[model samples]
Target: MGQKKKEIIKSFLLTLAAIFIMFIILFPVYYIFTVSIKPAATLATTKIELIPRNVTLDAYREVLFGFKGSKISKNFTGTIEGQAKIEDGKLYLTDGKITGAIKYGPFTGLKFEIPVSGIIFDVSTTENFQGTLKGEIEGLFVLTRMNDDGSIGFGIVREVELTSGDVNGVSVSGPMEKYVVIRNTGKAEFTAVGKFLNSVFFGYLKNSLLLATLTVLLSMIFVVPAAYAFSRMQFFSRDHILYFYLMFTQVAGGLGIAGLIALYGMIVKLGLYDKLPVLSFIYAAGSVPFNTWLLKGYIDSISPDFDEAALVDGASYLQIIRYVLLPMALPGIATVAIFAFIGGWTEFILASLLLTEKNQPLSVWIYLLMGGIGRGIDWSYFAAAALLFALPVFVMFMLAQNYIRSGLTVGGLKE
Candidate 1:
C-alpha cells in the first residue's frame, strides 16, 4: 500500500511538472500569434494580457499584399477622448485642431503637439512629419489616417513613448511604420504590410525550395549507401574511418570563418557563387556525417537475418539494400530528410555570404528587412515573416510526427 501510494505521488508530481513545462514552451508561440492580431496601440502597453482587447488581422494582409498600408475609408477606431470623421477626402478630428486629407493613425483621431524647431506650435503631428518617440518605452496611441494628399500622421491621447523594438519604426518623415495594439476607435481598420513582398518574395521562396529539395535528394543518395556499408558490411579499417567521420561531425576544426570565406571565394572563382544549386552540394556535404551516423544506427537495428535471408534467395547486395533495408529504415530516412530540408530553409549566414541579391533565398530577404540604417526595425513585418517561415517546417513536422517518434531510438536498444 505504501509503495503504491508513493508511485502515484511520483506520477502526479511528474505530470504536474510536464504540464508546467508545456505551458512555458507554448506561451511564446501564443504571444507571437497575439502580436499578429493585436492593434499597434496595445503594443506599447507594459501590461501583460493573455487576451487582446482589440484584434486585427491586418498583419496577415500586409504579409500577402506587401503594401505599405491599406487605404482607410470611413471605418477606423482609436481609444481616445475625441472622434475622427473623414469628409470630402479630408479628415477632421472633433477637437484635434487640424485639417488634412489624412495621415496614419489615431485611426479615429486625437490631438498631439511635439516640440519642433524651437517652437511649440501645438500643431497636429501628422504622419508626414517625423515625431521622435523615446526608444523602448511603450506608448498608447493609434496611427489614425494617412490622408489622400500624401500627409501621414497618428494620434495618441495619452503621452507614451513609441518603443523602437516594437512594431512602429522610429518616427520618420515618410509613412507611419508602426501602430498601437489596442484601439477603441470603432472603425474597420486596414493596417496590413504585405504589399512589399510582391516584388521578390516568390523568387526567394523558389530558390529556398530548390536548395532544400536538392539537398535532401543528394544527402539521401550519399548517406544511405555509406550508412549501409558501415552497418552491414565489414571492410579494412572501417571502424577507424567511421570514427574519423564521427569526429569530423563533432567538430570541423580547420574550417573557421577565414577558411569558410576562402572556400566561398573559391566557389566564386569557379563561377558557382550566386547559383541556388550550389547550396545543395554544400548542404549535402555538411549533412553526410550526421545522416550516416543516424542511418547506420537505424540500419543496425534491422536484424542481419533479413540481409542473410535476401542473400539465400539469390538477391544481390544492392537488391537486398534496396528492397529490404530501406523499407525497414524508412523512419530514420524520413527524419533525416526533413532535417536536411529545414537546415536548407534556415541557412541564412551561408546564403548571405555566398549568394548575391537576385539569387538569395528568403532567409537573406528577411535579414535585409532589418530596414537598413536609421529606419527602426519593422517588428510587425518581421514577426509576420517569421510566422510564415515557420509554417512549412511546422506542417512538415506535424505530418511526420510519427516518424520522429519511431526513429528517435536508433541503436535498437530496448529499455
Candidate 2:
C-alpha cells in the first residue's frame, strides 16, 4: 500500500513538472501570437498582457502584403452642386448638377453639364448619415444630417468618378474627385491603406526554402554513407577518427567571433564567398560529425545478421544498405533531416556574413527589420513575421514527434 501511494505521489509530481515545462516552452509562442494580433499603438506599453487588447490582423496583412498608402490621384478632380433636403430620417440631394470642368485623362478641362440625383443618406443619428450618391454622376458619402440652420447639408464625396453621361451626345467620364453642397459644402475624410503582395518577404522565403532544402539533401547524402560505414566497417583507427570528428561539434560554437573570422578568410581564399550553395555545403559539413555519430549509434542497434545474409544472397553492400538498413533506419534519418533543416533555416550569423542581399534568407531579413540605432523596432510586424517563420518548424516537430523520440533514444545500447 505504501509503495502504491509513493508511486501515485511520484506520478503527480511528474505531471506537475511536465505542465510547468510545457508552460515555459509555450509561453513565448503565446506572447508572440498576442503581440502579432495587437495594434501598433499598443505595442509599447509596460504592462504585461497574456491576452492582448485591440486585436487586429493589420501586422500580418502588412507583412504578407505591403502597406499601399492612400493618396488623392492628381489625375482626377471636379465640382458639383445641388439642393439638399432631409425627410423622415433620410437626406436626399435633389436636382444635382455637375456644372464645371472635369480634369485629367480624356476629359482634361472639358466642360460638362449633367443632371444628376440620388445622393441619398440613411440618417441614423444627429452626428452623421450613411449615404450613397447614384445618378448621372454617382458616389458614396457620409454627411451631417443637421446643419446649423437645418437647411444646408455638408459632406465630402466618398467616390464620384467614372460615371457615364452624354455631353452633346458624347459618352464621357474619367476618374474624378468632387465636392457637392446642397446650398453649402464641407469636406469628409476616410482613412485606409491599400495592399499589394510583399515581394520582398516572398523572396526571403524562397531563399530560406532553397537553403534549407539543399542543406538537408547534402547532409543526408553525406551522413548516411559515413554513418553506415562507421557502424559496419572495422578499419584501423576508425574509432580514433570518429572520436576526433565528434569532438569538433562541442568546440564549433565555442570558437565565437574568432572562428567566424577564420571561416570568412577561408571562404574568401577558396573563392566560395557569397555563394548560397557553398553556404549550404558549409552548414551540412558543420553538422555531419554529430549526425554521423547519432545515425551510427542507431545503425549499431540493428543486427549484423542481415548484412551477412544479404552478402550470401549475392547482394552488394550498396544494395544491402539500400534495401535493408535504410528502411530500418528511417527514424534516425528523419532526426538527421530535421536537424539539418533547422540548422540551415535558423543559422543567422553564417547566412548574414556569407550571403548578399539577393540571397539573404528570412532570418537575416527579419533582423534588418529591427532598424539601426535610435530607430525603434516595429514589434507588431516583427511578431507576425516571427510567428510565420516558426510555424513550419513547429508543424514539422509536431508531426515527427514520435519519430524524433524513437530516433533519439534506444541508440548506443548494445547487449
Candidate 3:
C-alpha cells in the first residue's frame, strides 16, 4: 500500500512538472503573437497588459504594400470667365476675353492635402512656351487684367505655378513633398514591435529546413555505404580500420575540423571558403561515424538469410545489396536520416563559419538579425519563426516515431 501511494505521488509530480514545462514553452509564443497583433502605441507603454488594448493589421498591410501613397491632383489654367479659342485642338488665349479659366481635375482627395510648388507651363508643338507665369496660383490659375475695357491678355499662356496648396484645403504653404503619419486610430495609442521578430523568425525557419534536408541526404549517402561495408564486407584490417575511424571521429571535435578546412584550402586551392556545400559536407562527415555505427548494428541484426537466398537465385553482391539489404534496412535508414537531419537543423558553428551573408542559412541569418547586429534581438519574429521551423521537425518525428522505435528495438530483442 505504501509503494502504491509513492507511485501515485510520483505520477502526480511528473504531471505537474510537465504542465509547468509546457506553460514555460508556450507563454513566449502566445505573447509574441499577441504583441504582433497589438497596436504600435500600446506596445511602447511600460504597463504590461495580458490582453492587447488595441489591435491593428496596419503593420502586415504595410509590409505587403509599399508605404508610398499614390498622388492625384487637379490643374486649372486659362481665363475664369473669358472665351478661349481651340485652334488645332489647343487652347489659345485671346484679347477679347474678360477673364481666363483653368481647371484642374481628378483630385485624389486624400485625407491630407499637400503643399504644391513647381513650374507649370503650356508648351506649343514647336517646343516653345507661349507665356510663363511664376509664383502662387491659389486655386489653380493666375489671373491678369488688361487696362483696356473688355480686353484680356492673349498669347500662348506659358505656365502657372502654385507655391502653396491646402492640407485638407485648409491653406498651408510649403514645398510639395511626400510625408507619412502613423496615426493612432484605436481608442488607445499603441506601438508596434513586430519588425525584428518577423524577420528573424522567418529567417531561421528557412535556414533550419534547408539545413535539415541537405544534411539528411548527404549523411545518408555517405554513412549508409560506410556502415554496410563495415558490417557486411570482409577485407584486410577492416575491423581495425573501422574502429580507428569511429575513435577518430569521437576525438576530433568540431573545432579541430577547422584545421582540415585550412588544409583543404592549401591543397585543393578550391576557394571553397565560407561555402554552404562545404558546410554540409562537414556536417555530413561529422555525423557519419555515429550514424554508420547505428545503421551497421541494424544491418547486422537482419538475418543474412535474405542476402544468401538472393545470391542463390543468381543475384550478384551488388544486386543483393540493392534489392535485399536496402529493403530490409528501410526503418534503420529512416532513423539515421532523422538523426542527421535534426543535427544539421540545429547546427550553428559550421553554418556560421562557412556561409556568407546572402547564402547564410536560416540559423546564421537569425543570429545576425537577432543579436549579432547593432539594435539587438527581435524576440517576437524570432519566436514566431522558431515555432514555424520546429513545426516540421516535430511533425516528422511524430510521423516516423513508430518506425524509429521499431528500428531501434530490432537488434536488441530476439523474438
Best by TM-score: 2
TM-score against truth, every candidate: 0.64, 0.66, 0.56
Instruction: Give the 10-residue window scoring lowest on summed lDDT in candidate 3.
Output: 182-191
Q: Write the per-residue lDDT of candidate 2 for residues 290-344, one digit (tens) a residue.
A: 9999999999999999999999999998898899999999999999999999999
- Residues 1-415 of candidate 1: C-alpha lDDT, one tens digit per residue: 9999999999999999999999999998877777667655233352456997687866656566442433323222222212333223222233322111222343322222222112121222343322222222223433444334333443332333222211134221111223323223322222222123222455567788888899999999999999999988989999899889979855773567876877788998999888778878988888888888887888888899999999999999889879998899999889889988988888888888888887888888888876552335545556676677778899999999999777767555632
Relative to the unseen true structure, what is the Cα RMSD of model 3? Answer: 15.3
Judged by lDDT, which candidate is best? Answer: 2
Q: List the residue pairs that clash in candidate 2.
A: none
Instruction: Decide which is better by TM-score, 1 or 3.
Output: 1
Local lDDT at 403 for model 1:
92
TM-score: which is higher, 1 or 2? 2
lDDT of 1: 0.62
**Candidate 3: deviation at residue 319, Å?**
2.3
Clashes of 3: 26
Q: Which residues of candidate 2, in runs, are more than 4 Å off? A: 1-10, 41-43, 67-198, 372-375
